[model samples]
Target: MRVRLKICGAVLAASVLVGSALHASSKPRENVTNASDRDYPAAKLSTLRGKIAYSPGVHAHSLWVMSFDGSHRRQITHAGAHADFDPDWSPDGKNIVFRTERGRYDSNNTGAQGIFVVNTKTLRERQIQPRTGGLFPAWAPNGKRIAFTGLNPTCCGEVIVTSKPDGSDKRIVKLPTAAGECLAWSPDSTKLAFCGHQGDGNWAVWVMNADGSNPHQLTHPRAIEPAGTGGDSPSAWSPDGKQIIYWSWQPAGGELFVVNSDGSDAHQLTHWDGGDEATNWL
Candidate 1:
């Protein structure tokens, strides 16, 4: 509960680009810090390759694509007043599924959010068929389904839900805590990693089978003092499916952390200012 409240306070006001870092199986690797979320020098931008999809804005976030080095940035979605975020590219790199607060309502009487898909090349965007309510959409590597935190009243509250890309055949991946968020699928698509409250009432990384079985906690970051707070929010898995990257918070600040897929060798990866987040692994 403390961490959940902190999550709300620490949210970036504008937007954040996904940061990438080198990864290895031997140990936790250092993260490559980006100069600025809004600007990258042309010389530096040319040195990096690949594309990154992110939601960029202060009041109204919308999906955008840019090179890994921050070059050739292009808008992908023009949702105007609606906020679009949590862009997850399909494994094949053809489409992206993300959450949009366009035309839905939540339990709090505020506008609810739902997932929508857009073709990376054509820029055509449409809401997922059959309709679904959720945030932080993650595409399974097998290219069959998208997993996200649910908002449907039938879910009873926030929980992990998986459904076809078109939003049909939905299935809830029940968590022991009854609430969860930030779902990431294993590279092999056999398991899911997410963030949820532990028995101690602190948020921690948790993993479960793709079918929603064998749930277990993976990290146990603790608050330094009684009044402080600690928690871990999983971002994504390494390419080989051997490790997971996440964000850990303590009284001092937040940092990136890495742990083995089997819940071993949990350690910090970044030592910079707190608030360092682990996004796409690249």
Candidate 2:
């Protein structure tokens, strides 16, 4: 259900064979610990950046973490059958939130896949709800609530929803996105930055009240596909809740961008020869 950006072994081999054909690049970033970055906003909680967690080679796999320079590569969770995807760190940096799916698909699912929590230190894992349908869990800055995408049977489409860490008091925050839409908790925990589709059929970054009110669209990019691939992306909230980092696609493929929380002063952050994804703040 979740959009998978990782390369498949088959695709990886082909990409390497044609690496020079689709070359891209990234622009210089001013600061790694600035207000626009997500990690800095959570510094008040002293959360550790910890390891760079991701899938090893494909979408249907376990979670992995690596050192800053890609050394010490290790798989942290051994989730089988249910593929582990969408790894997010708790505000305090002690635990991680992820979803387990039965098959490979975009990050969104129809409530069959469930959200889970794992303690980074002990590797202990548990589901917040024994049987729930959700994916792409965004841990709240205050460490009390979480936001994710789940099925809305009434609309027969996916809707944004939130619940306590214990999976109680669930509330729906309806928005326009099918799947692959990600949620980011504002540093203040009152608002959330997410991706939604625009009238033009392209995905754009958006912000909304965490309680499911006052939803607003922020970014407006011409989707290269000219149809819509999930609209522009709203990846993660800046540590200060002032801006967001998201990914966009062009003829050259996907690149990363950062925009003000109010949808102003957007700037390109990367021009990678391949592509970039919004993961941890860094």
Candidate 3:
């Protein structure tokens, strides 16, 4: 009876349209035929910007990777029903860390919720934290560790934890609150940015030092929407580590926004009337 709650704030607006028909051997059992499969036009950037990895499938989660200019689009996993989502590229761009569910949503649930790594060059896959119910994997800038949200099934929620790339030395960085998730490692790897409920009873973005020290609130709880509006969610940091990008669903629509790491200078980045949610800076 372990219910799966969609990881808030990780969903992107793009559709999951598989570019090529090359399928993987461990493909999950789900229908992606109706998924919107379109690739972003690739463009060249002057610097070696990093790629943005996200799950784009509307019905069934699918993992996709795109360059900073939306070029070099590729699908890293084809786990149909398992719903491979929340992809994070390795710091070196050689692999991706992601999550997947096994079997259909209703029947034959493997409880196979864990963090996995996929080789970008050869399309090889391996489980890094098998059956641990881990998600939102963020690789430390130093490339020695990965921070992710590990669900405590008995506790009915999740917490942030870090481990070596090989799944060794796993340690949970307990949050002040039990509900914190969506970890984003700072560029210097000294802190982790996440979203959680503060003592004020609303969801706001917060940050903590690498060892879970100095838990500071970044966004004011009052920044939340009025009743019936969607809540704010955790998001990615700019390459320079000066700002973070998140989505806020107001009365008009959901839009991407940037805020200083210290919770100052919050401003909108996209003006799509319909809405724009996912944003990652290279």
Candidate 4:
């Protein structure tokens, strides 16, 4: 079947820390009542199954997992400390990998940030990469290795490294000149998709062999820089390995979009005027 490319124009930008207080009051009284409410519009494809996990609201950094159909919603963690933002599910969907701060307001403290794993069924928690600063954790397609962004205080963003499930065999894969973030491993596990800045000061989507060879740029010349409002960016690879879904901000708010793996046929998927970011896929 030919993959249909869909790009949602609603762009959900990353939430930034406004103050020192890591934990804020929960939803307002009026908004609190709406917490249990859910509305899952039918998606074109039913094959996508897993729930979308993300940190919601302005002050609520807690992690949440909800079904694509808008049923079976649950909050996995209540860690009232620094907001837990990035959550990645294991290939088997049995465990969730994420990054969290050690204290309530220590975003700059690299020592406080590390990778952790949670058993979805048992609700048990354990630190996987203890004492090491990392973010944007992505599981390998085989569910054995995990790729994450390692931070080097002396430098900016560190190299992308894959480690064993237990935090062993940590090795860095050489990327382009810029630092890497928001990593997505291809379905076949042969290539990796990430966003990084080029020497020219523009952020663009880049692909590289899993073994760290033949790194190449995927976006066009005009969209290469950070100034352009819209263009290709980092995103997750689809299950079929034919397309990538990412967020782009144009005249409208930032929204989810899909494009061919080779960087062709870009299109929008969501049309929310307020914007919606693509957090994960089933």
What's the lDDT for candidate 4?
0.58
Give each model a TM-score. 0.78, 0.74, 0.72, 0.71
The alpha-carbon lDDT assigned to residue 149 of candidate 2 equals: 80
Q: After superposition, how far is residue 190 of candidate 3 from its true place, in Å?
A: 1.0
* Per-residue alpha-carbon lDDT of candidate 3 for residues 152-204, written as tens digits (9 for 90 to 100): 54665567779888778988787876457657788888989887774333556
lDDT of 1: 0.64
Residue 144 shift from truth in candidate 1, angstroms: 1.1
As a TM-score, model 3 comes out at 0.72
* Per-residue lDDT over 1-282 for candidate 1, one digit per residue giving the tens place of the 0 to 100 score: 322321221122111222344433233323232323332101111112356665554543666777654567788788678666667778777788876666653446522367789997898887773344666678888899988777545635566788888778988776777567767899888899987773444678899998889988998766444422567878768888999988776535666677898899987765544355535565
Ranking by TM-score: 1, 2, 3, 4
Least accurate stretch of 10 residues (summed lDDT) in model 2? 37-46
Better candidate number, 1 or 2, judged by lDDT: 1
The Cα RMSD of model 4 versus the native structure comes to: 10.0
Best by lDDT: 1
Model 4 TM-score relative to the real fold: 0.71
Taking the candidates one at a time, how many backbone clashes does each contain? 3, 19, 2, 16
How far does residue 252 in candidate 4 sit from its true spot (Å)?
A: 5.6
Name the 10 consecutive residues with the lowest summed lDDT in model 3: 14-23
